[model samples]
Target: MEVTPRRAGMVALLALLPVLAFGIFRTWWAGAITLINVLIIAVSLYLLMSPTEEEAHEAHADNGVENASDEAL
Candidate 1:
């Protein structure tokens, strides 16, 4: 459920690819569409690749609970 620093870095790099491509090869409208496409792709990739909510909850439940309780204090 936890994202390693290396994996986070890789995802960040992948998300920036569209911007880089746009800067290198497109005009205004094309760049805008490409940027939107990139965001969709990044979100899709994250959703597809990330662990399920149950898994994340199980992995971080203790920390999550503590944080929630702290917020109410």
Candidate 2:
């Protein structure tokens, strides 16, 4: 079965919690570092895993708007 990027990201995020918890238990400094790293990973995952459908839809919508503008003129 193909795992969607979204599912992969969610799994990764869920897995991150235990590691973060460990860091927090060790020291606040470690937790803060872990959090920063986690944030970076999350952002990267978000950007990389964004659905292609949205990009296609936005491109289509832009053309649609242009067509509508032309029609109005």
Candidate 3:
């Protein structure tokens, strides 16, 4: 299944809850867990902010490639 940004954010939130709990409980592994959470949050933010693959670049929108193919044809 494709994970949309919203889905990803939700997943990140779920993953973060345990880290937060560990942080609250002051577990030795809390720091490591929190670091991973940080990475997840960063990736979630990136996915949310950046355009999707389909929208990243206009497909067949660049004239350069089209021009080359047209010449060959």
lDDT of each: 0.69, 0.73, 0.68
Q: Give the TM-score of candidate 2.
A: 0.54
Candidate 3 per-residue lDDT, tens place, 10-65, comes to 66666666667777779767657786867777686757765767765665476555
Best by lDDT: 2
Which candidate, 1 or 2, has the higher lDDT? 2
- Candidate 2, residue 51: lDDT: 67
lDDT of 2 by residue, 1-73 (tens): 7766777677668757876787867987877778778767877786687768878787777843456657889
Could you tell which candidate, 2 or 3, scores higher by TM-score? 2
Q: If candidate 2 were superposed on the true structure by all CA atoms, what would the RMSD be?
A: 6.4
TM-score: which candidate is best? 2
Instruction: Summarize candidate 1's per-residue lDDT along 1-73 as a digit string, tens digits.
Output: 7775446546765766768678578776777777777777666666666778898877876653556557889
Each prediction's TM-score against the native? 0.48, 0.54, 0.44
Q: Point out where model 3 deviates above 4 Å.
A: 27-36, 39-45, 48-54, 59-73
lDDT (Cα, 0-100) at 39 in candidate 1: 71
Candidate 1 residue spans exceeding 4 A from truth: 1-25, 57-73
Lowest-sum lDDT 10-residue window in model 1: 4-13
- Ranking of models by TM-score: 2, 1, 3
